[model samples]
Target: MRFGSIRVRLTAWYLMMLALGLGVFGVGSWFAMRASVFHAIEEELADRIRDVKTFLQDQTPFRSKIDIRDELSEHSVLGLGGDLFQICDEQGGWLYRSSALESGLVPIRLPSQVGDQPVYENLTVRGAPVRFATARVVIEGHPYTIQVAEPLEEFYEALERFGLMLWISVPLLLIGAGLGGYLISRRALKPVDLITTAAESISINNLADRLEVPKTSDELQRLSETLNRMLSRLDISVQKMSQLTADASHELRAPVSLIRTTAELAVHEARTNTEYHGDMMQILAEAERTSRLIDSLLLLARADAGEGGLQHELTDVSTSIREAMEQGWSLAAGKRIELTANLNSNPIVVRGDGEALRRLSFILIENAIKYTPEGGRVHVRLEGSHAVVTIEVTDSGIGIVESDQPHIFDRFWRADKVRSRSIGGAGLGLSIARWIVDQHHGSIEVQSQPGQGSTFTVKIPLAEIPAPLGQP
Candidate 1:
C-alpha cells in the first residue's frame, strides 16, 4: 500500500481492515462454540455423576461393584452422542468404562496423584480425539477415582465450518471494496483530469483555450480566468509590436529608394559644369532627405523606448509659416506656382518647439508647391484664437484622392506615385510633419479629392502667448 499511489494505498488499507475483522470474528466464534459445547457436556456429566452416586447410596445391602458398574453402563448408553464416563480406584486403575468407546480406544497412563488439581486434558486416545476430567473419591475406607471423557468432533466441526465461511466471504468483500475505492478516487480527481486535458489541448501560438469549469467558484475556475486574462494582454502587446515594426519599415523605404536613385543618376552622367552642379545638388538633396528621415526614425525609436517627447517653447505660428515660405520659395517658383501667406499681424503663439514647428510648415508648403501646376496658387495662412492657433496650407494642384487622403500622413506614403518619383524627394514630408505636430499636442488633417486641390490644416493649443512681434 505504501509503495503504490493514493488509490492503491486506500484500497489496500480497506481490504486489510476487512481481513482483520473477519479473522477476529472467525476466531472468536470458533472459541465461543468450543466453550459452549464443552460447558454443556461437562454439565451433563456432572448431573449424571450425582444421579449415579445417589443411586449407589440407595442400593440394597446385597449389591456388588459389578452390579453397580452394570447400572452405570446402562446410563452411559442411554445418554449417547459426545459423552463418556468411567469409575476407577484411587490407585488409577479403571473399574468400569462407558460404551461410547471400544476397549482399544481408551486413554492410557492415567494420573496417579489426583487431589482436585485440574486433572483434565485433551488428547487423541488410540485413534479418536477426547476431552477428559477426573476426580478422586473414598468409599468403604478405600480411595477411588472417577473420570469423564467427551469426543471433540462436534466442536471441531463447528470451528471448521466457521473458518470455511470466513475464507469464502473475505475474497468477495475484497473484490467489492476494490471496485468501490476505484470509483471514489475517480470521482474525486475528475476536476484535476479535466484541467489537465484543457491545458494539453491549448497551443502556444493560439493560446485561446479555456477550461470548462463548474460554476462553484472554486480555485480551479479562478485559475482558468487568470490564464485567459494573461493571454489577452499578450495578444494585444504582440499586435502593437507587429504594427510598430511594419510602420518603421515603411518609413525607412523612401529615403533608401531616394538615395539609390540619386547615386545611380549621378554615376550615369557626362562632364559639364551645369550638369555636374545639378548632379551634385541632386545628390546633396537626397543625402539631406535621407539624413532627416533617419533622424526622425531615431526620434520615434527613442519615444518607443520610453524617452520623452520633443522639447518645447512658446512659438509663433506666423513666424514659422513665413520661414517655411522663404525656404520653399525656390521650389514654388520653379513650377511657376504662386505662393501667398496670410499671417496674423500680432504675435500668434502656440506651445511648440520652434525648429520642429518650422519644419512641419516647410513640409506642408513644399508639398503644395511640388504638386501645383504652372500658374497654380498656394495659400499659407496662420491664425490664432484664445483656444488654439492654426497654420493652414492650401494648394491649387493635382489634389489627393479621398481614399489616398486617409493614408497621406503614413510614412513613405505618396498620393501619386509617378509625381512623387519625378519630384526626386522621399515621400516622408507629411509623416514627419504629423509626428512633430503630434509631439506638441497638435493635430494635422487633410481635406481633398481627386483633381480638387488639397488643404493641410495644423491646430495646436495656445499654451502660452508669444512675446511682442520680434524679427528673427
Candidate 2:
C-alpha cells in the first residue's frame, strides 16, 4: 500500500498482471463449458425427434383412427425419464401427449413452416428449463409435427456448481498470489537496504570502509564497485591535502621567523650603520624569498583550479631552448660549472603557449644548474622531426635516488630537503613545468642514478604542415 517504496510498487504490478491473466482464463473456461453442455443437449433432442418420426412411419395402414390413436397413447406412455413427445397435425390439433407435460393443452411456440429438417431451441415448460427439437414428417402422405423435449435441470445444476467454485477459488488464488509477489519483491530489494545502511554508516573519518559486494555479477555489483573506487580516490586526495598543509606551514615559518628575528635585533640595540644595513638586507632577502614562494604557490593553486589553459600557437621551441641555455650560462659561470647547448638547424614548430614553453624550458635548465656541483657539466639539446619535438637536459650532478624519482614533480617534494633549502628553492618549479608541458599535450620524463648524473627529457607534438599557396 506504500506507493513510494519500490517493493510495494513491484508487488502491485505483479498482482495486476496475475489478475488480468486469471480473468481471461476464467471467462474462456466459462464460455467453453457452456458451449459443451448445450451441444450435448441439442444432440440428445435431435436423436429423440428422429426416433419418434421413424415410429410413426412404421404404423399399419389398415388400422382405424381410434386404433392409431391407441397406438399413439401407448407410444407416449413408453417414453419417460426426462423425455417428452408430442404429435400433432399441421393445423395444431394435438393427437398425443407424453406424461412429462403437466397439462394436455399446453401451447408451445413452433416454426410457421416446419420441414423434415429438425430445429432445436431452449424453452421453459411449466417454469422448468427444457431443450426441445421439432420436425415435420409425412405418414401415408399426411403431414404431422413432432416435438421431443428433455428437462435441463441436471445440466443447470452442474453449471451452478462450477460457477460457485470459480467465485470461491479466484479470490483465494489472488490473495495467495499477492502474498507471494510481496515476498519475492522484498527478497529482491534486500541489497538496496544493505547499500543504504552502509552509506549511512560512512563518514569522512571512515571513508575507507566500503560496501560489501554481492556475489552476483549484476548492476548492483557494479554500483558497489564504482562507489568503492570513488571512496578510494577521496581518501588519497584528503591525504595529499593534509601533507600540503603541513609542508606549506613549515616552509612559511622559516622565512617569517628569520625576518622577525633580524628586525627585532636591529630595534633592540643601537648598532652601527653597517650592522643595521646588514640586518635590513637580510630582512629584504627573506621577504623576497617568501614572496616568491607565495607567488609560486598561488600559481599552482590557480592551475589546479583550471584557471588558465594553454594558448596554442605555432611556436619554434628551439628559440626558447637557446634563450634558457643563455640564462643558465650566467648562473653556471657563477658556480664554476660548464654550460652547453646543442640546438638543431631546423625550427621545431609546436602548438603551445610561447610564454609557458619558455618557462618550461628555463625551469629544466635552472633545475640542472642548481643541483650540479662546481666543475660539473650541464647539457641542453633540442632535436625534432616532422611528428614530434624533443628537449633533453642532462647534468653531471648529485642525482636523485630511485625511490624519490616518482615523487619529484609533486608540490613541495624534495629528495634532499636540507640541500634544496640551502640552494634556495621551494620545490615548485618542476611541478609547474610538468603542468605546463601537460597542458601542451606533452610528456616530461626523468632518468637518474644516485651520485652519477640525471637526464630530463620532454616530448611535444609537432604542428600540422601548411598547404601550398593557391592550392585551395
Candidate 3:
C-alpha cells in the first residue's frame, strides 16, 4: 500500500482510533474485574468472621478454651478449601488456630489493634497470595479477636487468563478491522480514480471532452462539474483564438502583398521619375495600413492579457467627443457628409483614461463615417445624468441586418466585407471600442435597421466627485 495515498491514510487513522478505543476498554475491564473479585473475597472473609463470633456467643456458659477450640474446629471444616481462621483472647493468648494455619503453609497475622470494624490485608504466604480480615468481638463480657484468610491463587489465575485473552484478541480484531477499513476507503474513492483517468486522457485537441460526472451528490460530483465547466471555457477561448489568428492572417496578407508587389515592380523595371514616385507612394500607403493593423492586433493582445494599463483619472467625456468629431470633420467633409455634435454646456466627467476615452470616441465616429454614404449625415451627442454619461453616435448610413448585429463587434468581423476592405477598415475598431468601454465599467450597444440608419450608444458611470478646476 502506498502510504501517501488517501486510502491508506484513511485506513491508518481508522485503525489508530479503533486501537485506542479498544485499549481503553481493555484497561477499564481489567480494573473493573479486579475490583469485583477483591470485593467478593473481602465479603467472604467478613462472613467467616461473623460466623466465628456467632459460634462463640451461642456457647454461652462454658467459655473454656477447650470448648471454643472444639467448636471452631468443627465450624472451620464447613469453609471452602484453603480457608483459615485463628482466634485470640484480649490478653494475647491463642484460643484456636485452624490446621491450615498450624501447618505453617499460611502465616496469618493478628492485627495489633482490633476495633469494632474489620481490618482487611493482603499477604503472601508460602509463595501464594492470600487475603486476611481481622475483627474484634465481645463474648460473655470478654474481648476476643478473630482473623480469617482466603487463598487468592484462583482469583489471580482468572485475571491472568482474562488479560491473556485480551492481548490475543485485540490484535486479531484490529487486523480484521484495518482490512475492512482499507477496503471501504478504496471503494469510496473509486470515483476520484475514474476522474483522474478521464482527465489524463484529455488533451488540447480534445478540450471539448468532459469528465464523467457521477450522480453521487457529493464532492466528487461537484469536482467533476467544476472541471467540466473549466474545460468548456478553455474550448471556447481556444476556438476564438484560432478564429482570430486566421482572420488576422487574411487581413494582413493584402497590405503586405501589395507592398511587396509594388516594391518588386519598382526594382525590376526602369521607370520615369513620376512612375517611381507613384510606386513609392503606393508602397508607403500599404506599409501604413499594415502598421495600423499590427498596432490594433497588439492592442487587443494586451487587452486579452489584462495588461492594457488604462488610467483611472477624471476625464471630460464631452471634450473627448468634441475632439473625435473634430478629427473626423475633414473626412466627413471630403465625402460631402454633414458631421455634427450636440454636447451639453457642462463637462460630463468620468473616471477613466483620457487618452483611451478619446480613442474610443474616435473609433466609433470614424467607423460611422467610413460606412455612411457620401452626402449622409453623422451626428455625435454627449449627455450626462446623475449617475451615468451617455454618448450616442447616429449615422445615416447603410444599416446592419438584425442577424448580423450580434457579431458586428467581433474581432475582424465586417457586415460589408468588400466595403470594409475598400475603406481600409480591418474590422478591429469596434472590438477595441468595446474593450475600452469595458475597462471603464460601462456598456455599449448599437441599434440599427437595414436601409435605415445606426445609433451607437455608450453609457459610463459618472465620477463620484466633480473634477477639480483646470483638471480636464
Best model per TM-score? 3
Each prediction's Cα RMSD? 14.9, 4.1, 3.3
Candidate 1 residue-wise lDDT, 1-472, digit = tens: 3346656676678778877887788778777877888787677655555555455555524578788677666655676222477766655566677655547466534435566433567868666677776665555555556666777777777778877877887778778877887678666556667777876886656665555665547775777677667777766666655665776576567667766776677678555788778777877776776677677667656655656356677777778777888998898888889898998789877777777788889989988888888889999988877688888899988898777777887655676667676675446677678778778787899887557698998988887544577843
lDDT (Cα) of model 1: 0.71
CA error at residue 396 for candidate 3, angstroms: 1.8
What's the lDDT for all of these models?
0.71, 0.83, 0.88
Off by over 4 Å in 3: 61-63, 80-82, 104-112, 466-472
In model 1, the Cα lDDT at residue 342 comes to 90
Off by over 4 Å in 1: 1-282, 306-309, 464-472
Ten consecutive residues with minimal summed lDDT in candidate 2? 104-113
Give stretches of model 2 more than 4 Å off.
50-89, 93-97, 102-120, 133-154, 214-218, 271-277, 299-333, 336-355, 437-441, 463-472
| lDDT, candidate 3, 75-164, per-residue tens | 678762224778777777778888767765544334347786888888887788888888888888888888888889999999999999
lDDT of 3: 0.88
Model 2 lDDT tens row, 46-147 = 777777667666764677666766776776667521247777775777766675663863454333468688777777877888877788877787788777
